[model samples]
Target: MPEAIHIRPDAARPIDVAVGILMRPDGDVLLGQRPAGKPYAGYWEFPGGKVEPGEDIFVALQREFVEELGIEVLSGEPWCCVEHVYEHAHVRLYFYICRAWRGEPQSLEGQAFAWQGAFGVSPLLPATIPLLEWLDRVRYAQPS
Candidate 1:
């Protein structure tokens, strides 16, 4: 039989995470598969990571991109915030719209990458679903 672990209410607090919604001029956005062994492994999501203590959201975004994608985020702006509760952790996701970067994104981590249109991808992380809706609204709102 497996041991049952008890978690303190305070210890189950929400994690603060930064996510980058990298958009190309052509309207496609970048999504990366969560690498093996990570929580929600194989699920597609905007690439980003936990905000280290004392780190600003932009700084966290930049650091995460460099570490995970090997690219320097040249320009990014705050987009949206979403909170999601999963079985393992509750997370507050700070999303940024990254339209410019210094290097072509290559998955330095062992994750696959995709450039997808608004409704094209599937099996996205639960937290990512709302962000996709926001993207669709913003992308289509522009004059055609």
Candidate 2:
């Protein structure tokens, strides 16, 4: 007999999010602190937000960058996608590597943001930690 599949009665739908990692020429990347009154408040994360219905992921990424950082994304590409479940919601995050943008990143949402090479921030968001680890590993890899 086949094993029965057990599904949670209250399984939440995964919300699509577009995340932007702005990388400078010197290998530094941007990190932002979640503002008060939001989920995971004070936890550091990459800049991004939920993708609205019918919106293109790239369009969502550009919109989020401009809204959250006050910068115009000049060049970027999709890097990877990952799904995470938090106490509040399940999220499907689409990450993009933003290499060029216009204007300096500013905290427009009452959040703290910084360009970090060594990531000294405390309490990083759960989903962000793995990405940072992956980034470190990639940056440390020997060139073939």
Candidate 3:
């Protein structure tokens, strides 16, 4: 069996990461509402940024998380991935499940933060819908 798909050749810059904080203990996690004034603002998303050259992913993710969400992630493990192409940019999102953290989350930027339960939760960012769906599917399998 085959599924529908799209594929394109990589340009000079072919990848970018979607960094995420994965709060566990039964399907709970954080989401941030991007403040009005920037690209993709007013949408909700997991906090992270571009993966730069020569940066180890663990270090890059930690730095990006702190800068974007103001929380110190204690630990994480590789989870899932997604890649999307916008008109001007293309990126491959390497997602991770951040299991632990220090310092209460503060909106270093002006974004609003929420701790969302898996069921009946809506994604803050449209780009994040896929990740949210994936998160729910993974969390829902837990014995409740």
Most TM-score-accurate candidate: 2
Q: Provide the lDDT at 41 for model 2.
A: 96
The residue ranges of model 2 lying beyond 4 angstroms of the native Cα positions read 1-10, 137-144
| Rank order (by lDDT, best first) | 2, 1, 3
**Mind giving the per-residue lDDT tens digits that candidate 1 earns over 32-94?**
998889888889999999999899989999999999999999878788888888878888899
Best by lDDT: 2
Better of 1 and 3 by TM-score: 1
For model 3 the local lDDT of residue 92 reads: 76
Against the hidden true structure, what lDDT does model 2 obtain? 0.86
Candidate 2 residues 92-121, lDDT tens each? 999888787999988888999888999999
Model 3: number of clashes? Answer: 2
For candidate 3, give the lDDT of residue 139: 60
The number of clashing residue pairs in each candidate reads 0, 0, 2
Q: What is the lDDT, from 0 to 100, of the residue 130 in candidate 3?
A: 62
Give candidate 3 regions above 4 Å deviation: 1-12, 119-123, 140-144
RMSD each, Å: 5.5, 3.2, 6.0
lDDT of 2 at 32: 94
| lDDT, residue 1, model 2 | 100
